[model samples]
Target: MEEEKRRLIMYEKLMAEIDLGIHAIDDSGKTVIYNQKISDIENMNPQEVLHKPVREVFKFNEGQGSTLHRAMTEGYDFRDEKQTYFNNKGVEITTVNNTFPVMHHGEVIGALEVTKDITRLKRLVQENMNNGTRRYRFQDIIGRSEPLEEVIEHAKRATRTNSSVLIVGETGTGKELFAQSIHNESSRSAGPFVSQNCAALPESLIEGILFGTAKGAFTGAENRPGLFEQAEGGTLLLDEMNSLSPDLQSKLLRVIQEKTVRRVGDTKERKIDIRLLATMNEDPVDAITNGRLRKDLYYRLSVVSLFVPPLRERMEDLAPLSEYFISKYNDLFQLEVEGISTEVRKLLASYHWPGNIRELEHVIEGAMNLITEEKYIEFTHLPLQFKRKRPRPPEHNEIFHEEESTPLLKDYLFQQEKTFMQRVLKEHNYRVQETAAAIGISRQSLQYRMKKLGIQKIRE
Candidate 1:
């Protein structure tokens, strides 16, 4: 009995020292031990909670899920169960708990509950989901490609200065991730980091929300500080910059130049201190030509341009990114997914990925949801779109039935080169500049290839 008493004392000491909340109840549901951490979380004294009934102590809502009650009454163990309630002060609290029935000699004796507070983190995640972006640091970016590495290095350098940065990439290329990373790395990281989508709002509201509006400025107008003032001494991200009207673009240029803004109906200009990061979905040059973006504003905003390569260009990262997403979703959905099959990996790598990483993540997530009791994800578990038959050229055996009819490698290479040049020329309507840029080569190089391949522009 003395040895058992000593063990119980040691267990109590260990539980008290730990940071997370822990509380255990006796067989009759009366509290046996309530530690200091639980006291702190509940904003109540340990003395008040000691020797109380479990349901009374927690005030569990009758119909709502109750981890402690279920574990004790049903003799079941629950892991990572979420519970929410109001504390003594009427403050709402959210927690993830592991509640288990304490057994002795193959019979249920009591119940113990361990909890960790995740209220703040949960709120932030919800905000990000609603806004289409989140706070992320450099470590969150997953990539090993040379182009991606170069861009990361450039973004790190950009954090040292207050110059405007323009991140140019196609949609779903993680422009917002880079912007948030820069903000987190900058010297003013402790300050607020605000993001707004220029394309998500109308022009009139966009301007007011960005530059603030004084009372009497318009109907139902109230004096307010816009995103600029809210992000004082910090960073502001303008997403989809090309969507801003020319007049708004001009105003933004003036704000960047003068370092001041005048709220509507107010003549007083407020001096501001902020770092700006802007993102564009389409090519900036195309935006300029289409008059969707002002050229001078582009030059000013792109003082440090960081280009994020599309997924198709960094095919080597597909496997690692896939594994990362799998691990992430496994934690999220509580699955036992070991990894993707070799055939599935190859299929993912070969995909054109017009939607880039975002689309790949959706595919993996969709597949994971349908996978059950599988050690590894297989090609058969992939989405139906992936199951669709893809056309292929004749196989080697079909192309050369005769044993002596082996084709030379150089001849095959020449045919492939000719086909690629013709396809690119046709896609660009034979325009030298567009075709060269699309092919990621200089116009002179494209011209040389055209002459070598004897390819001509197609007429409509």
Candidate 2:
């Protein structure tokens, strides 16, 4: 009898030490074990709860569902089921419960419930739901060019509201950085800042990802929240928005207008409240003309549009941006590098950085990795591609070489036309609508000529 008492005391002590709330009920719905954790979680006295009817102790409304009651009567089990309701003291609580039916001799005799208080966690979820964290601020963006300054100023003003913002720029132009900065400056800064790149995702899965999936909607589909729902009361950045399919674009427009989303294969709409920031490497007009983007959606998203200038247009910022990258990499690599060679700077300035800021950062990082105990980045340390000299302009004599045979008029005219088209396309950063507008032609006509002349579109 002494040994049995010691064992009972040890069991009670073990139950008291557990963090999870444990509540048990016998076949008559009378409480059998109500651990200290359960008492604390429910804010009730153990003496007041002991041997009481389970439904009465929990204050379960008549005809309302209760997991422990279900387990006791139906002999079923539930795991990780989330329940939210007001307690006896009128305090709202959210909890995840795992209930199991106790069986003896092939008959259910009682039930045991394990619960975890998730009220604080659910509050956090409602406030911020980004998968990870955002680490960018306005000060992190380094630039001084006029166009860049204009973009930065516009972006700062966009943080004042929950309205949608559309950012247009070429690849490597720091679109995502701008998005993060805006989110950090907004009222929703404490909330989540989620981002998704439409171009990086497969076409078939984009819809399900942005919306959500209802249980039994498809193979392996469960009742899951989507980016929009997850970003409730926060910010959602949709990068490369132009790459989304037309069907998806239409649905996106509806969501933006109604502030509600219907999960895939689910008929009911779930309302959401979130700020939107979308980025596109191509011109929105081009996307519309090509039927790749919906016009209404573009208009809705462009409530406040900001455009980041390309590196070639913002050459003045190259030096500052390079210096910034150098300083960043120095800390990252634990290097004492101070500056770059004059020749290296000249080379960087002269060469058009087709990849913009991202490419510049890569070049600096690669050079930093190669340098050891060097005070400065030398010309030799530069990438081989950047080391190559730019092709010199053709001399007057070379253009009209006396020794070379004169070209045919048709060939000469065709070459001139192709060269002009290529220059215009490059000036517009290969954006179809902008190139067409600049070259005084329709998008369709330019596309046809590009196809006929074998001029390939440059990838952003």
**Runs off by more than 4 Å, candidate 1:** 1-134, 389-460
Model 1 scores a TM of 0.58
Question: When superposed on Cα atoms, how far off is each prediction in RMSD?
Answer: 18.7, 14.9
| lDDT, candidate 2, 418-449, per-residue tens | 88899989888999888888878778568756
Worst 10 residues of 1 by lDDT: 391-400
What is candidate 2's TM-score against the reference?
Answer: 0.59
**Candidate 1 per-residue lDDT over residues 1-460, each given as its tens digit:** 6999999999989888998899888888888878888888778788777898756656555576567768988988887777888765666678778899998999888899998765643443334234423569878888888768878999999989889999988789899999999998889788878888788775646777788888767643458777778778988889998899899999999999999988877888999999998999876765887999998898899888887887766777878898899999999989989998877765675555667899889889989988878978888788887567331122222222334333445335757888888887888788988998997876755764564445654542
Quick one: best lDDT, which candidate? 2
Best by TM-score: 2
